[model samples]
Target: MNNVINWFEIYTSDFDRAKKFYTDVFKLELTDLPVSSDRHSQMKYATFPVGVNGIAGALVKMDEVKPGAGGTLVYFDSAEINDELSRVEAAGGRILRPKLNIGDFGFIALVEDSEGNLIGLHSMA
Candidate 1:
């Protein structure tokens, strides 16, 4: 397989707040994604920049989706983990663990998003 993952969704309770947090932390604006069907009237989401290192993802909010920690953790690839970690707190996220070397694989850091989701940051540098 060229890539195992195609897209990902990060669930949030507060769409606006979560959008702002992600935009601020990543330094990129999220384009709103609309739901056309009434069955998903309560759903709202915004996608991250496409083709970002070939990973596509979105911040979603819906009734059935609950945002929290200790679930499936998604790791965001970074050129430098510190660059993103440095802005975590100011963007409303808490750094659970600072960047740590992972030998040949590279470095990784754990953090909690504004919505309380645990996210990992990875970098080769």
Candidate 2:
């Protein structure tokens, strides 16, 4: 298995605000995707750029889907957790936990996104 997870979706209530929050925090672009499926015709989606060997995911907005915090935590790979942590609040997020060493697993931090979604940041630094 190349990866345990292939795709993921981060639900949002405010599409444009959420998009800007993510883009500002990560310093990367989220490419808007054209809806291709009838089942999801009403949902707006913008995907985080998938690296050559990384998983693909999108931020989604729809009436039925709601974003919440403290559920399943999704960890974003960080070059240095501090770099991203520094921008969390300014980008419309809250740092729930400061960076800490995780023994041999490196370091990790927890944060809440603009959409009230609990997300984790990880790095080996």
Highest-TM-score candidate: 1
Tell me the lDDT of candidate 2.
Answer: 0.73
Find the candidate with the highest lDDT and give its number.
Answer: 2
lDDT of 1 by residue, 11-58 (tens): 887889999999989899898866533442366768788785676667
Task: Give the range where candidate 2 is weakest over 10 consecutive residues by summed lDDT.
Answer: 34-43
TM-score of each: 0.51, 0.50
Q: Rate residue 89 of model 1 by lDDT.
A: 94
Q: Candidate 1: where are CA atoms >4 Å away?
A: 70-125
lDDT of each: 0.72, 0.73
Which portions of model 2 miss their true places by more than 4 Å? 37-41, 70-125
lDDT of 2 by residue, 38-117 (tens): 34236677878876877666787755447886323467877798999999999999997678564444665778899987
